[model samples]
Target: MSDEVVENDLIHCIYCNAGTVRFSEADMVSLLEKAREANSALGVTGMLLYEEGSFFQVLEGPAESVDALYEKIFRDKRHRRITKIIRESIEARNFSEWTMGYAGVTRQDLKEIEGLNDFFYTKKCFTELDPGRAKKLLEAFKDGNWRASLR
Candidate 1:
């Protein structure tokens, strides 16, 4: 048998019930580290999004390895409320470089998202949502856009 490895592009979304854990800077570091290990071990590459104290991580890699990694993640004590979004085969990785990336969404930001209709909010979840809606909603906020509001 040879040591050569086969690879494919598969996107995996691992959900986390972040409500149980307190969000902190230390937790951020640990989360990224685990993501890095998972990516390296499974030959996966993708990005992570944490919002409203929830985790939405996307990983792309070999079918078998990615599945195995997913199982491990589900079993990990640090991770709970695991929900595998979709693990279908894809032609390429959406976020082919980052081990993990973090974004902070404030209470006001949550309010903005909530104000959006179901159709618009769902699109923002996985699909490419129209920036117009985001702009409009942000404009409605007293603080303005995310950048300005977050500041």
Candidate 2:
């Protein structure tokens, strides 16, 4: 394949970190807007999970666009301590239609990582999380495993 096609067709998802000023209703709207704007401008797609006072976001798109967006995100003061979780060129987009899908995770959703050191602060752990394991953990949260984590 030609290099142009190779570059444009490559799919990748990268996780990122940011801090929240306040988890208010207005903040939620602004975040959704920011994601949409970023995705539209960069032709990116991905999911965002916000919890506690931190931000955990994923950006998926053509390899080049994703990388560029990541660089921009790193420099933005609205978010800090930027780290890359993973960057693999895949064959398909996991979040195809989402310009910037957003989700707000509560304290309940963070039970798994609560006592596991600073897992959230360390991007490497997120990168190492296989999709299945990540999904299982998330499912546990959704299934009301919040209290169970303390046991």
TM-score of each: 0.60, 0.64
For all candidates, what are the clash counts? 0, 0
lDDT of 1 by residue, 36-131 (tens): 876776677655545545554555677777787778867877656666545667665544455554455543445455455564344433233234
Candidate 1 accuracy as TM-score: 0.60
Model 2, residue 104: C-alpha shift (Å): 0.6
> Against the hidden true structure, what lDDT does model 2 obtain?
0.59
Q: Against the true structure, whose lDDT is highest?
A: 2
Listed per candidate, the RMSD to the true structure in angstroms reads 9.1, 7.9
Model 2, poorest ten-residue lDDT window?
Answer: 142-151
User: Which candidate achieves the best TM-score against the true structure?
Assistant: 2
lDDT values of the candidates? 0.53, 0.59
Candidate 2's TM-score: 0.64
Where model 2 places Cα greater than 4 Å from the true spot, the runs are 1-8, 18-20, 112-151
Q: Candidate 2 at residue 78, lDDT?
A: 70
